[model samples]
Target: MKYTHTMPFGAAVHDNGVRFTFWAPDTALIALERNGLAAAPMTRDADGWHRLDVPDARAGDRYQFRLPDGHLVPDPASRSNPDDVHAASEVVDPQAYDWKDAEWRGRPWTEAVIYELHIGTFTPEGTFVAAQRRLADLVALGITVIEILPVADFPGARGWGYDGVLLFAPTAPYGTPDELKALVDAAHGLGLMVLMDVVYNHFGPEGNYLHAGSPSFFNAAHQTPWGSAINYDGDSSRTVRDFFVHNALYWVEEFRCDGLRMDAVHAIRDDSSPDIVEEICAALRDGPGRERQIHIVLENDANGAHYLERGADGRPLTATAQWNDDLHHAAHVLVTGDTDGYYADYADDPVAQFGLALAQGFVYQGQASVFRDGEHRGEKSDQLPLAAFVSFLQTHDQVGNRAFGDRIDALADPAPLRAAYACLLLSPHAPMLFMGEEYAASTPFLYFCDFGPELAAAVSDGRRAEFGKFAAFGDEAARARIPDPNAASTFEASKLKWEEREQSPHREFMAHIAQLLAIRHRALVPRLAGQPRGGRHWRDGEALRVEWPLANGATLQLLAHFGTQKASGIRQLAGQAIYTDGITTDLNDTLSMAPGSVCITLQEDNTHG
Candidate 1:
């Protein structure tokens, strides 16, 4: 049933039927075209909205909108697209699906273990229903939340959902609305929270007809890689903001999505005029289901706390979580010792990297960025709960954006990889694992797009040009690095081999992740309580140690050795050896980490026993 814009969008199905109302101001005419029923043109109200009181429209009947040109299209505001990816939208009766999660309390950000995955490459079937069956596996793995990549309809049936054109419609390839619901239900049953990634920064190049209808949806004042930035502060922004707000609510209320991990929030350029994010948050929290909690996570490079701040009214409008790139950079540089691109600012100082990330939010806070040559900085994480900083050594972007999707497992020495994993997972920040990383899957996460030959060529060329701004690779090398976006082999090679979990080093890595997860669950549980109680000590050029104190009065100390070779000058404290990779402490009670080796706790009291 269509609900007017002035009136909050609500639905109720009676024996007589449902009444649908839509707000389309730019349209010359609007019609409600139901399946197998005579078409009825909706009369426009004073506010430019059209309302059709459909007495015959059943709860589950399919419908579409007939534009002024007699061109029928799927409803842009449709709650559910039931006819699969490329078919007509259905009139979803939101109450039709029986939700067993009435008593299902939502998970807090502090307790969240987010698993980011691409739907296309997540499983063998590569569909929502197929992914649903594996929720138990995630639940078994001690994952509290599953963050699915962007699902908005992109160009083809198979693609990374970030390049979406149909922002309103869920990708037809993922599954039907009911199927999505089933997946969410399954996740809920498994006690796993679901966070769907939503892209609002810019629309893809193709299938974006929003401009043809209304150019005001974007503004030229800000340009982004994807396209013109969204018209967040420009003309007709109220309606634009409403559109995205509705999209956010649709996922949570209709599809049972628990949260939204907003992709590239930094790209969402908005002026001082009518704070966009605040309004969006207001719209989501204003609905009938007042008591239900919905989480919002943002991916930003700035590491600014402004996005996490409340409104003038003191309302908590901050994102529930944000990706901590500093943590990734520190771990990447410390473990790999590769100082190319942004990594230039972050090598030879694991203590500085680890301590600052644990203390301040970013390592290069207010420092001149070697890559950009400008001042780049971040907020201090000391005031924020450790969980607020989402830590990950490897994510899809880190791996897939590379010349090849080479994971840490592909590196020569497994010891450094293992040490890096230990440092990342055992740290104070909330940890995230890339798919197949737990098992050290050897398959690469190559960049695969579903574009045709022409677009594929453009993508390859564009990728090389973009990376050329930072690194100097030959044209042939760059082109060779760009996988054919349209090739089936590209996507095929990206899939994780679940069977690898049983293999040699894969099994060993899995054991490590499992054990680390257990330790995190037991010791780190209290850190999720929104209290940031962590201590750190770092010598500017030598060593840095960060400590997370547990409720049991025990401490989880992370000592990082920055030198390439083991430093044996510091004193050694004799304690029950918990973890070490042939790395020992120095003469002055300082641990000499062998290049990438991480030594755990050491106390003289334990040695006396």
Candidate 2:
């Protein structure tokens, strides 16, 4: 059939048939192979987009593209890869699913209490439908946002999703694309906004077919740790940029995702004016039916405060927020006293480092980074609103990338861990909790993959070699004990033991977290959503004092004693004890705090000099 269509750059179902469009500028000839049928020539436009409308093809029909070299490739924008990443793409009707969240306008960024979870390991079933069963639990726990790890189709049945190759297809193991939508819809129904993590820096090593059709998808001038950088600023960059920008919109518009967490944006490497990140944010904001406010966050190691800067029109140029590693690093060091690798920088004065991170958005703003060979890093972001930072005590990388996959709670004493949780929840920045972290589930989130034998061996060896540099993993015995990424048991071991949520210490921890979140909702969130009145932090001996004036005629003060000895007569009395972790007795002008204790007090005196 020959007709013009206004659908997106992927497989779209129409009243008569399924229309397929792909961008392959480097290919001379392209054809469509539908349901294992003979290859049919596809009409090509001057813009290098190949189009084919097959009246016989309908929803559930399998299709693949035959390149100039006669190699079949899955659609780059496939919505559902039911078989696997390398298999044929299935035609899906986007409008077929019945969504009940029509009245669901997403929550604002200021009220976000994100809980990051890996879908595969979140539940025993490890599917979207299964994960949806726990949404009510999160709602009860006061989680406003749920940040799921990447769902893009990868090589095998299980992975961390960082190795996703088919960016559009939700992994088959987790369930169908419609099921994934159901999960998002269910979350929205419970008043929870769902944000998905997307990796655009580089495609995965396996099952990547973009190069078979067009080399312009990647840039030779730039390289990232993962692989070649995407051609965002190189020749034929506009098409490459559009491919990803459409993917972002696909999730937001088609899947009804509330937001996205762009992974490793520092590796994007664009020198062009109004960088690719800016283009993506603008496109998302200007998308069709832009009624719901869309939020974009960045996971940037560079601490790029510019990503959060507003343009002349007073809208954020790139992302609404960036992950604050400075806060995490300082908090980790303070709680565990571990000064290895990047944690070395925060070791000298963890409290001071954390204080700087609280007062400013970054601790390394023009300061020498001891881990980076004394190189000055980061830019000033103190003027930005606290909502521009996402702070957490533990994250996927912080916990899973460890040699033993030990969480902060596993490494620290209960007293300090509780204190750290108070700091994270009460901080001005938005706080996130890793899966199973609130109750301290004993399951270790080890790095697992499902690569073939050869790639699996290589991954196992590379993992060992990477961690071998650390003294903890230097011993041959310890190195041998590292979980093999290829092992099914390793993947199974990472699953959360939901039963533990009702156990002794786990129950206590959950209650504490619930109380802390209640306090945040009652006291902190209101003040945070208002005009950005700046805050202050100071250190006295081994104790830290943080005070921020609220919209009401009161000030919020957090007094934390990080030293081993008890701090006596730390500070004067306050209005009310909003939250306390390890403090005992009422507070007067001469209150004492046990070691590793934290108290959050509300002082009625807002005019303190």
Candidate 3:
């Protein structure tokens, strides 16, 4: 029997059978072991790749690889792991699913109003099919893009997908591979571009079989906080690099995803020329991604400006944008007034820092990090376009990593939260919101996992120790109150309460968001899509003034007061008031704003008001 190979690796399905390919340079012997059948030896090439074609194998058939030591292991590039990560891999035909998004060309980064969500906690059913049913709700909420948390297979049914093991397979707990595709197709049908979060930094602690197949997969010299770093510059690095690049293409081409949000790219250590990230981005741009625009975003804690730098041709070097922690930290400190841990740096003159973050891509660019003992951090990003930064008030890490997994609304005053939301949505940069952020759902987004007893104890102890550094969680009793990651109730509690959207404050908040988004799409976004021609920001006592030159020969002005008392003596000279929240309604030469108020106005002239 013969099988046509579509991918360089993995289980490719054809009419006759499936073709299996594995790259195991360290292993001498390899065999294909199908369920309820004898093991068949596979032929190995000089490059250390083992291949075998089995005509009897079909879609839904379970199989594993037999090593020389007689140990059976799942495919390193399995497409579908119907069972747990430790179980056998199942064959899946990528062409079996009929998609209905033929006319869907993805939206650009400038028009993206990203909504990040975890499937398990997003819906009560916690399945891709269930989540698909709620796409219309998100579409109605003014979300142009959906950035889903990682969906790769993990050890158990529930976990924040950063700990995913099987890179190619969508977690079985969510739904079948085809069902996940359906979700993406449905989103495209509703004019929503879907982007998946892919983890290339490290694999989960459990169910990792890469070392068993090839020890060269990990670099022994470099050590990450999670474990040994991946071999991006060491021996046999070409194949190692290809594995990740191929995975990126697999998601884009097979799943019909518009983009990928690479998770924790700062943790990915690569010293070779033409860095792995650059290579991956180049591949995406040159491969199937060439047909449609694919936006690639990075989560880099290092604030590496090179990722957003443009070449001589004026094209970006690597990613389309990066998550701006500087913006989030400054905003969090200003609103919540929590000056512990990393937030300590922004404690001093947080308003000024927030203004800088809005004007520049990062406030810490080439500056000393007070939280790191005055160590210099971040590269200069002032020259980059505003679209190169992703600004958000709340994200999965910011909320779930908290001692009690509290959202911004839970920690800050209501007025300030509203002010913050207005600033976030109307800012020049791209903005993202957490799952229930639009309606302010009451459910907590906690960190929950389903590890075994031994690993669970270690994780629980480590989680407590991590928060112990904060003064608020220093008390042992407070630490004990933290939810256990292994508990089923912890995962259940994180599920969003969709019914709360009809409540009082929640419904009001939804209306506010809708109005903000309408103004953004109808007025601001069209004029400020890529970058602002010029911008200025200043701290006026407890209030902040931000001004940007619009593409239209007009000046956009935003005045926000974060102090408790009303801001008086503000001159009311403006063309049109686009948005005003919690401000005094006296039309005079002098304007007074209530505490935690924001006012945005567009003046035809460039003169200061």
**Which predicted model would earn the best TM-score?**
3
- Comparing 1 with 2 on TM-score, the higher-scoring candidate is 2
User: What is the Cα-based TM-score of model 3?
Assistant: 0.96
Instruction: Return the top candidate by lDDT.
Output: 3
Flag clash pairs in model 2: none
Residue lDDT tens for model 3, 1-609: 111215677788877798999888888789998875899999899888999998878888899998898888899899988888988999888777888877776876778899999999999999999999999998888889999999999999899999888999999999998899889989998999999999999999988988887778999888998678999999899999999998998888889888899988888989988988889899888875668878899999889998898666545668889998999999999888998889998998898888888877798888898889998999988777777888999999999998778988888888777888888898778899999988888888999998878998999999999988878788999899999999999999999999989998899889899889988888777766435432678966667888776654677788898888888877663668899877775565566888889988876645523
Candidate 1 lDDT over 126-194, as tens digits, reads 888889877887777778888888888776657778887666566777776667778887888887888
Model 3, runs deviating above 4 Å: 1-5, 311-315, 530-534, 585-588, 603-609
Q: TM-scores of all models?
A: 0.86, 0.95, 0.96
- Specify the poorest-scoring 10-residue window by lDDT in model 3: 1-10
Q: How far is candidate 2 from the true structure (C-alpha RMSD, Å)?
A: 3.0
Candidate 2: tens digits of C-alpha lDDT, residues 1-609: 111213357788888888899888887789999898899999998878899988878889999999988899999888888989888999888777878888877877878999999999999999999999999999999899999999999999999999998898999999998899899989999999999999988888889998888778888788888667889999899988888888888888878888899999887889888888888888888873278878998998888787888655445666889999999999889888899999998998888888777766688767788899988888878767777888999898998898667888888877776887887798778889999998998999999999988889999999999989998788888899999988999999999999999999899999999999998998878766542534778986668887765555567788888888877766654768888766665456566788878888776644644
